[model samples]
Target chain A: MTAEDTAAPARRGRPGYDRQQVLEVAVRLFNEQGYDATSVSDLAGELGVTKSALYHHFDSKSAILEVALDDALSGLESALDDAVRSHSDASAQLRALVRGAVGVLTARQSRVTLLLRVRGNSDVEQSALRRRREFDQRVAAIVRAAQAEGMIRADIDAAVATRLIFGMINSLVEWYRPGGPVDPDELADDVLRATFDGLQA
Target chain B: MTAEDTAAPARRGRPGYDRQQVLEVAVRLFNEQGYDATSVSDLAGELGVTKSALYHHFDSKSAILEVALDDALSGLESALDDAVRSHSDASAQLRALVRGAVGVLTARQSRVTLLLRVRGNSDVEQSALRRRREFDQRVAAIVRAAQAEGMIRADIDAAVATRLIFGMINSLVEWYRPGGPVDPDELADDVLRATFDGLQA
Candidate 1:
């Protein structure tokens, strides 16, 4: 093998960036700076490509954002779907959901961050928000299912429980960083434990 | 005095413009747009003032951010200080702190929104973060007091518990809105109860 072959594997997929690579960069840029603040020109510059090239990949900035978030959330729903099917009981399902949420929140932190901060300022934002509400309703249905089984408290509204769980889980984006003190798996365990056991002795 | 003169309270002290009012406007703008995205012109436009007029109120954009955060935090600390002094046990103190936090979060939702999203990109941002950490430590101290009182679980680290509690509480800024349904006081009560009691029956 020649020098090119030796370095070829290390530079794998460096040129001719795929859809995912571009979307990943876009997510970071959108999160680091505000979404409205980031332009097609900025995205192209960040990718070291021309604006026309980026336009070829996505028709518009909103198109890129639309697909990026739709992709992230679609991935999350699949993860939850698997977790929900794996568990037989409500307790197990809740634990699995929390753990799975941590996985998604950490692995796709930027994408999730974008999802949580949607202000409903534009049509794209409104659509993303509607999907988000739909996602929450799905999780609430599970929580309601749990409540019926005498696992979760029946007195508390399912909407409230869902909101609180979201409060605890959604916050991971702000403080959680991979390669930090606690791994996502371990952190998920503690979080699930707290959600179940409460902070009381 | 005439009835009209007596009905309306007199505005006194600072004549030109109230610094608090300016900071409030700036924070609202910061929350609507993000911190990095909000320019001085944006703030001035929001305030219905000229750029030069806005600069007279603040030396720089960072200065506006600095004093705004300081003012809000000082209000928070004042409430926290009272709560710490009045509560007999750690659990009660934590409850008081949580309640006080809701008031702070609601009254200055925009400021707290900006607070929760600080990325530490500048010296001002980093300093604000350091101050926030210290505040967290103070709350952790209260949590430790509760642990010593045998109200909260001793097995968990105070730091981690504090982080989770804060995470849940701070999330209100992301999703909460000012409306008649579930007031701030009720929201705070539910948060405190849920934090201490598992969602389980």
Candidate 2:
């Protein structure tokens, strides 16, 4: 990305910088080079500032990671809630959940991708893991409700199904290029159909 | 892993120490701790030996990585060959490819997982990338054959379809805990079934 993409340190002599903006650049770099491979100095360099300037915005790398991840977790939970409540039936709820998830992933590909790849290496990563587990638990509850309604197989473990769905959903980041042949919605539709319905016909 | 599971060193009478034996331990450590986090001394400590003893086996950590990777690639080629020969028809061939791929992942979970997560930090990683691309090309050829037989989607790029199949198949490594809730063969079967037949029934 260009320095301009990082936002000039003095575009029209704007205020110091947005905390959120710094986190965005940090997430982009983390996804591009991986969490361990990326450095705080590298992020500051990209933002057209010194390392001390970055320290001013975020106490530590993990602090930035915490804020970015919490933002994603909050967004995901609220979106899933809206999607689930939008429909009364299991099929509709599941579909809504898939589409809402696709919307989140497509919009915040970098942040979500980082979340999916977290290895519990640090306190920040472990916190991300806990929140992710909570997300899975919520999805599992919905899956069990769907099964009770006979919308999904009762034999399959809700926990396993939730993981499988997230695995497939998270994988979009690896292959779905922005200008690819299929649009994000189309890809999401294909995935939802493939997951919700069996291809015996 | 237990010490007995490690590949025994060649020309043993002394301590059975050699370049290959050291690499086996190093690869295991790398898989467990990740590539960037592992160091030469850390590897030596894991192998139940001193740093100099480890050094006597291989020149450096990089050499160990190169050798271990080469070993994994050779196995992959053999697995691909079997995938092609497992079945004759388009659909069966695709299923065989998925099942065989799963078998490979399960049998060599740690090694294959490490191979999949390469970060391209060095020339060795770059070579692994090239070899992976070649493997993807082989899968693309299989998808093309299936499409010609009217068993696969003709509209989507064959390469794109192949990658999605792999994304599903490879995800086994991330969550397919053996003796957990699911069996490997059954999981592979479900994956193959899910891949070819749309999930919607």
Candidate 3:
């Protein structure tokens, strides 16, 4: 990321730097440099702002993390909501959720990396972790419903199944760079196909 | 983890602390506390030894990480090698690889977690990342050979397919507690069943 990505800091009290812009820079920095190594002063330095200027937007580094994690997970939650409301067929609903998840992951690659890798070491991280579990439970419920309806295999436990499928999807955080080799659309398609249709010839 | 887990600090000239014991403690600390947050002093404090005593076994934290990553990946590489040599058919080979991977992962949970989550921030981390990619490439080659033999679907890229399968398996790091709700044997079975025979009814 270049210095120009973030607008130059005009003055300490200036309103030129947007909250979203600071967040974008902050997330990228956090992902590149581990969160523990990144400081508020570091964020300010990258943003071309003073320490107080950055604090005006976020009280602490953890506050930025809270918003960043929320940014990553909210898209997923909303997408699942849309999938549940639109699809009645259990298989279709589950497939839609998987596709939606990949889309969100690709769109918010850096934020998702931070969200998925957090170890719940702080209040903000713990909240993100809890929300992740809640999201997993919601998906697991869908799997259970699908199994009961005989739309999917019943032998595997619903929670286990949910973890595996999402596990496949979430691994995108590790390798999927936004402008890298595979485009997001193609990546999502391949993931969905592999998940629903076994790789067997 | 109690102070008792680490052997007491012996005389500076003595070889009381085993290299394996130091590695085990390092991996646990790395997993519980993020690698960046963990320090030589922290390891010494936990081990009831002086910093020099901890350093006597491993020169630096990065050196410890190198050994830890190697410990995790070597098991996986050897498992894949054994599977390829022992199995004739592609499907059988792939099945063996998946099962073997789960077994290694379950046995070395903390080490695997460290290997999977490292973000390539330093020379040691970058080397670990390269090794991980090489492992993924090896698995992809198996998938491609399997597809050629009409054992697995050819429509998806071998790389993509391998990732999705391993993603599901690797997710055990996130949720599979050694003595937690799911048993290792059962977890391995369910993972294999879900991968080869997907959830579709």
CA RMSD per model (angstroms):
4.9, 3.9, 3.6
lDDT of 1 by residue, A137-156 (tens): 88888888898898888766
Q: Could you tell me every candidate's TM-score relative to the true structure?
A: 0.84, 0.85, 0.91
Candidate 3 local lDDT, B72-187, one digit each (tens) = 99999999999999999878889999999999999998899999878877999999899889999988989999998989988888998888898888988888887788888898
Tens-digit lDDT track of model 2 for A1-201: 335545445555433557878988899888767778689878887787678878888899999888878777777887788877798876577778888887788777777777877888899889889988888888889888887887776655677667667767777777677776768887776677556653222
Q: What residue pairs are clashing in model 1?
A: none
Model 1 / residue B28 / CA error / Å: 1.9
**lDDT for every model?**
0.79, 0.74, 0.86
TM-score of A-chain in each prediction?
0.86, 0.86, 0.90
Cα misplacement distance, residue B83 of candidate 1 (Å): 3.3
Model 3 CA lDDT for position B199: 73
TM-score for chain B in model 3: 0.89
What does the lDDT read for residue B95 in candidate 1? 82
What DockQ does candidate 2 score?
0.39
Q: Estimate the lDDT of model 3.
A: 0.86
Candidate 1 local lDDT, B1-201, one digit each (tens): 122332345243212445666777788888887878889888877767677767766789999888877766776787789898998787988888888987888777778788777888899889988989889899999989899999998767788888888888887777678885758887887787678887767
The candidate that achieves the highest DockQ relative to the unseen native structure: 3
- Candidate 1's fnat? 0.69
